[model samples]
Target: MSKWTTANIPDQTGRTAVITGANTGLGYETAAALAARGAHVVLAVRNLEKGKAAADLIVGRSPGASVALQELDLTSLASVRSAAGQLRSEYDSIDLLINNAGVMMTPRSTTKDGFELQFGTNHLGHFALTNLLLDRVLAAPGSRIVTVSSTGHRFVRGIRFHDLQWEQQYNRVRAYGQSKLANLMFTYELQRRLHNTQTIAAAAHPGGSKTELTRNLPRPVAALSSLLEPLFQDADMGALPSLRAATDPGVLGGQYFGPDGFGEQRGYPKIVGSTDASHDADAQRRLWAVSEELTSVSSPVI
Candidate 1:
């Protein structure tokens, strides 16, 4: 296949896209590219001021770009609900819902709901957001839900059902891996649930891109990142796989997209595969059940 950059993104005219964490890094690049291509992009961020700033930047670069801002704090279930309600009221149909906002290897902490921070923000948060907006997304013609995961998922073998939240002891990297793994599992299960609908579910990874997500990395990891910064892809390149997963007409449900470079890092976007554990249907189902129980938000699609 020829190189698939943002330039290859087909016309997004008339589509409405909701991108979490659109204020910076990969999410910002994703929002900007889609807006430039004629999509009315909503920057669903935790901070309104920052969201507006991102919107301004996008509009500045791409004249006539329709970019809006909406506040969404993924760590808080209430915030997610409010954001979803506001979005549903505004858009009759949502063409794309990108579950892209996430936290990395932070010190052990819990979210507003008392769940593990990384797992809560990265997986459960998006899980709730996507379900809350499922109706709107399903209403839209050929809608797509793209969840952003990471190569770090290889760090964990599978979901630790016994200690899903890492409450006993939290190793930052391991927790991060579990959360990302949950992201893939969530996507897989959601696709299965929505198989009969026009709304499809897919996933993508940024492939070791330089982004603000590294702020929470461990000291050693941070130091290593600094040394390897030169090899990391820029945010725009990192956002390509997500862009492809969300807009690629040929993309199918349950498929994953990532970089084509060595070890699936730092290159053009392409359809990629996930770990065997990630493809475990039984585990995916269990995660979904646990998620619905934890968040008390169930998808009508299921």
Candidate 2:
């Protein structure tokens, strides 16, 4: 397939999009692309400086691009709620919801809510945001919700039902992998739930791109990662699959899109497959229940 770049993006004029973690990495690229195409991009980020800088960067690229920075910390429920409510108040309807922010292998850490950092930020936070924004998303005719997962998810055995928090064994990498897998599972179930509804939900991954998503790693580990750049796709290239997943009118619910390359690592965007474990209905239901319980948020007005 030919390369997919932001310049080639189809027109998204008048559409409003929300992208979590829009400050850097694939998230910034994704938001940049959408904003370039004339979509109003609400960048939901935890850091005010970085978030505003990202929005300004996008606006700089596209002079008339509409970009807003909204404070959001996925690690905290209070933060998420305030941001969600603020977003609702700002825009009557959200045409696109991109759950793009994530955390990685850090020292064994947890969110303010005490859940594993990876699981809380990557999966639960986005899950709650999507559900909370369901009203605006569904309220818009033919809207979509896209959750960004990772190829790293393939490394996890599966999301552990009993120890969802990983309180027992604290291997950061495995925990991160499991959390990403949970993201994919959440995407699957959300699409299932949106069946026959106006909103469509799909999942995508940025092909092994070098980005700030790895900031949590140790200095030594980070230096070792430089070797990955040559082998990994660029962040803009990596953002293409997500852009496609988010903007492709042909995209369907439950579809999984990613780079079509060796080991599913780095290449152009295309629809791909997920592991069987990602298809577990039981686990999805459990996750939904646990997410609502943990976040203490109300069910959205779907």
Candidate 3:
């Protein structure tokens, strides 16, 4: 199959999309492309100023692209819920949702909701948001949910069993890997649950992109990353998998998408195989139950 690119977003006319962390990086690129294709893009970000700035940037680029901003802090369930409520009130149907915001490995820290920063922000938060907006997604046939994961997920040992919250042990990079694993697991289980149903749920990973997601790296390490990053792809190029996963008509639910280059690092978007843990249905089901219990929001039965 041909690789998916920004130019092939199916002229998203009349569609409505929500992309988290859309102020910059792959999220911004994704939003800009969707809006340019005629989707009414909503940038749900943590920083209002950056959100407005991103909107302006998209408008500047797309000229007449319809874009709006909604504040969202993925670490806090309260914040995610509030943002979803606002979106539910403002829009009747949602054609796409990109669970793109994330935090990479960093010093052990807790979010406002007391979960590990990485797992909380990257996995659990998107879990809540997807469930919260389940109605809107189901209401709009052909709607899709695209989650951003990482090739780093293969290194993960899967969700921490006893200390799922990472209270007992904390390793920055491992935690990040676990979170990304959770992303794929979530997508697979969601697709399983929505089986015989409609909304598409898929996961994509951007090839090594020079984005702010690596900002958590300490100064010395960051310098090394900067030196190495240029050898990879740019954020706009990196967003192709996400853009394709979100808009491709041939893109099947539960399919994992990523770059097709060396080791899935840098190339055009194409179907890719995820880790074995990602296909663990029992784990996915357990994670779903835990997520619902933690978020206190069950997915809509429709």
Candidate achieving the largest TM-score: 1
Preferred candidate (lDDT higher): 2 or 3: 3
Question: How far in Å is the alpha carbon of 185 misplaced in model 2?
Answer: 0.7
* Tens-digit lDDT track of model 1 for 1-302: 67998788889999999999999999999999999999999999999998888888999999999998899999999999999999999999999999999999999999999999999999999999999999999999899999999999999999999998898878999999999999999999999999999999999999989899999989999999899889899999999999999988899999999999998888999999889999999999999999999999987976
Q: Which stretches of candidate 2 lie over 4 Å from their true place?
A: 1-3, 218-224
Q: Count the backbone clashes (under 3 Å) in each candidate.
A: 0, 0, 0
**Candidate 2, overall lDDT?**
0.86
Candidate 3 RMSD to the correct structure: 1.5
CA-only RMSD, every prediction: 0.7, 1.8, 1.5
What lDDT, from 0 to 1, does candidate 1 have? 0.94
TM-score of each: 0.99, 0.95, 0.96
Error of 3 at 145 (Å): 0.6
lDDT tens digits, residues 168-266, model 3? 767787888899999999999888877776888999999788898897875776788778776789999899999989988898999988999997889
Q: How many Å off is the CA of 193 in candidate 2? A: 0.8
lDDT of 2 by residue, 1-302 (tens): 46655656679998999999999989999999899888999899999999888888898998989998999999998898899899889888999999999888878888998998899999888878888888889888889999998887887878887888888878787888898899898888888888878988899998778887777776775777776668887788888888998887788888988988886679888899988888989887777778889887655532
